[model samples]
Target: MRQSPNDLTPGGQQRRAAIIDAAAQLFNEHGYHQTSTAMIAERVGCAKATVYHYFRQKPEILFEIHDQWIEELSAHVADTSDDVPLSEFLRQVFRDILQLMETKSDHVRVFFEYYRELPDELRAVATSKRDHYERVIESRIRTGVDTGALRPQHPRIAAFALFGMCNWSYQWYRPGHELSDREIADELFEIYFAGVRAESPASP
Candidate 1:
């Protein structure tokens, strides 16, 4: 069984986080199936038994990575004010996501690539959170549509397109590239907004 946060000492909490960090790097370098608990322990400079003390199994570590990544993103989105225009909201959210990809590349990789390797029960948790995140995006799109800020279209489809543009950047985006992450996010947002923006009335 995983150690409960309520029970863990401050040091214990740090150790658990260290284990997750080490495991994320290893998982990104070597496929999850190829990476072993022993490798994670070695990377963290702890014994394998110590890793087991915090997590019951390898899949638990995978779940931790996915859970933390999604929670961070969800929290950021939640903080955004409803008063902000959808265009501005998208710009902010996309930039935040790209910035995270720049810093937490391994975590983002595990989120996108290794989720299916999780056990059925654990996979369900990831799926549920992901579904909730998508719903949040769809809700914003729906609000934009109702307010006439966005064109009349399927909110769900619009949300997926937004995710596609933002999330897929983990595959190709690099820090210190010719275009900064913010620049890339802004350019992509413009492409998305152009398709969805409501048309203005004709001039006399």
Candidate 2:
């Protein structure tokens, strides 16, 4: 019988985790289509069959990457409520996403770059998760509008704009001595919530 991720022994579990980590790096460096199980095994210091023992195929690994991102992000925002000010809520989102992207940079890179390559069924599952996340953001934005904590705009579009701004960090974000994720998130939120141009007298 194939061992489920949770059913692995202690050592087996370690190898499985290592395989995912190595696969993420390899997938990020080489596009998903270009990466092979052999490459992942080599990176993990194991035989190619070991990867299959854990994941049925490369696409399963890709789907797992997407699953990890969505689940963690979902859990992070599960406590959100209108009781919190919109600014605080949005700032938290910015902070969380930036933290995840910074720490799991390789995973972020692979998720953005390879999710589309998943099989149709896996892709559907991923899309459902993505949509659910967007809906939560939209719902929060609507509440913010009703409570006058945020400006009026199409909530769905606003959610897309926010994610688009943050998700692209995978392309060029580099952690260094220059700035911290919080600082970057601060700048990003300031730009997102506050317009660049001066507000006109009649704006309100």
Query: What would the per-residue lDDT of candidate 1 be over residues 67-125, giving only the tens digit for each residue?
Result: 88888889988998888777788788788888888878899998799888889999998
Best by TM-score: 1
- TM-scores for every candidate against the unseen true structure: 0.93, 0.89
Per-model root-mean-square deviation over C-alphas = 2.6, 3.4
Question: What's the C-alpha lDDT at position 49 in model 1?
Answer: 98
lDDT of 2 by residue, 1-204 (tens): 246767878999888879888888888888888899999999999999888888878888888887888888888788776577667778788888888888888888888877778889999999999898878887887766655556666777888888988988767777764888889988898898784112331222
Q: List the residue pairs that clash in candidate 1.
A: none
